[model samples]
Target: MQMNDQRDINAPRAEVWAALLSADVLKECVPGAQEVTGSPEEGFEATVVQKVGPVKATFKGQVSLTDMVEGESLTLSGEGKGGAAGFAKGEAKVRLEDIPDGTRLIYDVEAKVGGKLAQLGSRLIDGFAKKMADQFFENFQSVVEGPADEGSEVAEAEGTDEASKKKGWFGRLKG
Candidate 1:
């Protein structure tokens, strides 16, 4: 599956970058994120509960940032295993640009699932992935454009946090 997203943040490029990479912000933004272990400056380990149709599983995974070009762009890759449910791997390239209003955050993502999970079909997986991505960006926008608090403050530089909303990864995944 593939996806793309863009958000206009009211903060500066530096601030947007910081908030986007913060561990606290990511933990809050990412759907079903249980714990974020490691640094957003680099990456981290995560456990997330995901579901599709009648299938449900908790996934243990690692996410990392690679092919970085300072404030220009970066490549992030990760994989998750849901025990009996199946496994999935994905990569996304994010780019930052200065816009008339603020910083424009853009991303292109691609993902693949295997095992019994793959049998669920592509439309399901694709829809699920898009939903997850939307959730993350939505939270990011709220934080970056709203206020600057301890959690909402920028991470390495430009950043923010997704409120106290505890996300449940429950829904039929579209592929």
Candidate 2:
């Protein structure tokens, strides 16, 4: 499947570019991402658990950044193995532009599946891929823009632990 989208983020292009290269930020934005580690120069290794239609699987993958043009644009490519469930691979071409509001983040993505995942039909796979991409960008925007609600500050003032803060973050994302 293939898709393209764009979002205007309320932050500087440099900040957005830095966040794109941060594993911690990527881990938080990705749905079901349990862990993400590595540097931009080498690559990143990730573990993600996901459900598509009737199949659920844990995917182990490696993502690499290439053709980076400083704070402007870059290409991201990754592949994951899900054992019996199937394998998934994709590439995303991302570009950043300076906008009066902040920064405009644009992306074009193409993905493919094999094994059992390929049997799920293009419609289902396409829908799932679109949802995932949307969710990731939404999450990234939220993170870059800071807390979405005043309750987060209240929680922090109330001395909420790190775990509680994370839980609240996820709750807000879902809501």
Q: After superposing candidate 2 on the true structure, give the runs of residues whose Cα lies further than 4 Å from its correct spot.
A: 149-175
lDDT of 1 by residue, 34-99 (tens): 987788665888898878767888999999988888777888789999998999899989999999
* TM-score (C-alpha) between model 1 and the true structure: 0.79
lDDT of 2 by residue, 1-175 (tens): 9999999987788878988998988999989999999999999999999999999999999999999999999999999999999999999999999999889999999999988989999999999999999999999998876665567677778787642543323334444
Q: List ranges where model 1 is wrong by over 4 Å.
A: 147-175
| CA lDDT, candidate 2, residue 49 | 99
Whole-model alpha-carbon lDDT for candidate 2: 0.89
RMSD of each: 9.8, 6.3
